[model samples]
Target: MIRPSIPDRSDDPRVDVSLVVNGEKVMRPVSIRMLLSDFLRHELGLTGTHVGCEHGVCGCCTVHIDGKAGRSCLTLAVQANGAEIRTIESVAHQDGALHPIQQAFKECHALQCGFCTPGMVMNILARFEEEEKLDLSDSGIRDMLSGNLCRCTGYINIIAAVRRAAELLGRA
Candidate 1:
């Protein structure tokens, strides 16, 4: 009996990717195997974007892809080509002040280990900014933040922080 050999799938050139990062446009050559989280943290030096699970199960690698929250670990850097990418670092005042969401997180002691805070804050901020009128009910808050996971704080303080942030932003 003869066995078939596996096919070769190499010899592909790297793709040229261009993306607007934190309001600035950048162009770079990237390999097809590069992950968006690795690109942001390694290539761009944006360490604020944390990578918890390489899989999409954990939300620690979440970032705003064109104003919508998504898992960076699962996204290819090539897919982000010609798109606006917003990490946790971008969610701050132009004057270098902390964004209301960040401020609220600090004020409410929403984080302990600080690993999941960035993704949580980014996800919440995206929703808070997109929706003109937000309802800050307990169930609503739980549903909105359902994507983000927090091992510390049991999420009570995080929920309170998001509520306070909504109030501070005048969206509640």
Candidate 2:
């Protein structure tokens, strides 16, 4: 487990947050207004959950909260009390074997700049795990990725990656 490198600020108003993160139990006292993204990145030292639009429109801070994809930047640390949060750090095998979705992203060349990749993977991974069968068609894939925005690519490769990920995960 990666130890948190941030120093605690006791002077700020804080709330006790206890939650399971990437299969590890984390209990911390964080500022009441701290965003879940900030808590994950700063308090717990999970940097995979990126923060892009601070506004939740970019989807760069997506994480699995109680098994559903949610924008971590839009969520408060206190709001996630007792919730199970899964960051992109947990997607791959312990030995560094990439998750199928991550492998698909690489094989399909779905990322450029790689800023939005983690959130994109987390969102797609949730759908892949929850749905029995996903519609891998172009329109369907676009709908699935509607929440995320990528500035580098035209999304042609991203859509293709989603299809490839479906096949790799046996969802197709």
Candidate 3:
């Protein structure tokens, strides 16, 4: 059997991981067992990447890794070495303006308790990146949001927000 490729640290399970987070480079020692979600939340203090269910199925810990959507809860901190990560905190401009997706969500009233919003926004952003544009069709919207889960809003407003973001991005 192949073993994990993580390098061993002398007195602990820590490993060195260097990555770019929200346009800033960061290097930190992370335990082998640490989840990327926990590292983002506890170590880096980027709590915008929320963790609902530890399992990858929930998609609540979604983040952009190397320009693609990934489940931070399912990813190990060591596995993210040398990657570029974008959490919800990065969705806004440095001038404090909302991103198109965030603006759409706000305008469309897509959130209630706001727990699953970050993941939904990140996933939609990644989807726009992957698909280049959205058709805004019902089936297309459903397919785009296949992995994310929301307990409130029933996705009606969310779909509207996705469409509005597509329009704002010139991708509709």
Candidate 4:
């Protein structure tokens, strides 16, 4: 019997990361310098977390780390070890039913080009989940969305979607 040769990667620096992703526990070996966004998208195949601005200025890579919204692009995979990470992929039901936030976005036409939709939804979802009372006023919504930048839709629809989502969540 012939034995297949396996390549050794011991010389390359890597760290074992363990975390709960989309309610499932996962463990993987990632490069020491790998960004959380890259780890999620490339290693875990969760591409919903977009990488827009590598500098983390754009909110295109927002995700829930330990139930708090954070920029995945700015976080290292090793730093997220033992943390709960939720990406946009976890928003919908297993049967493909859209979450209320996604429904609101669709009803209000919050997205154009759809590049920023995932991050926007994740950011808004975190706020809704964490806040006891949210300011639904236009200015208040603007304040909440200050971190995310959307070139399309001019934010008018996005703001409307936030309010609609709140109403759907019974938080309005």
Global lDDT of each model?
A: 0.87, 0.91, 0.89, 0.91
lDDT of 1 by residue, 1-172 (tens): 2423323324655899999999989899887878898889878999999887678766889999998999999999999999999999888888999998999999999999999999999889889878877768888899888888787778888889989998788876
Off by over 4 Å in 4: 1-12
Give the alpha carbon lDDT tens digit for every residue of 1-172 in model 2: 2535445656779888999999999999888888899899877778889888789999999999999999999999999999999999999999999999999999999999999999999999999888887888899899999999999999999998888887887777
Q: How many residue pairs clash (N, CA or C atoms closer than 3 angstroms) in each of the candidate models, in the order given?
A: 0, 0, 0, 0
- lDDT for position 93 in model 3: 95
The sequence of per-residue lDDT tens digits that candidate 3 reaches over residues 2-106 is 424334444666788999999999999888888899889878999899888778887889999999999999999999999999999999999999999999999
Alpha-carbon TM-score of each model against the true structure: 0.90, 0.93, 0.91, 0.92
Where model 3 places Cα greater than 4 Å from the true spot, the runs are 1-12
- Backbone clashes in model 2, listed as residue pairs: none
In model 4, what lDDT does residue 134 have?
97
Per-residue lDDT of 30 in model 1: 80
Worst 10 residues of 3 by lDDT: 1-10
Candidate 2 wrongly placed segments (more than 4 Å): 1-11
Better of 3 and 4 by lDDT: 4
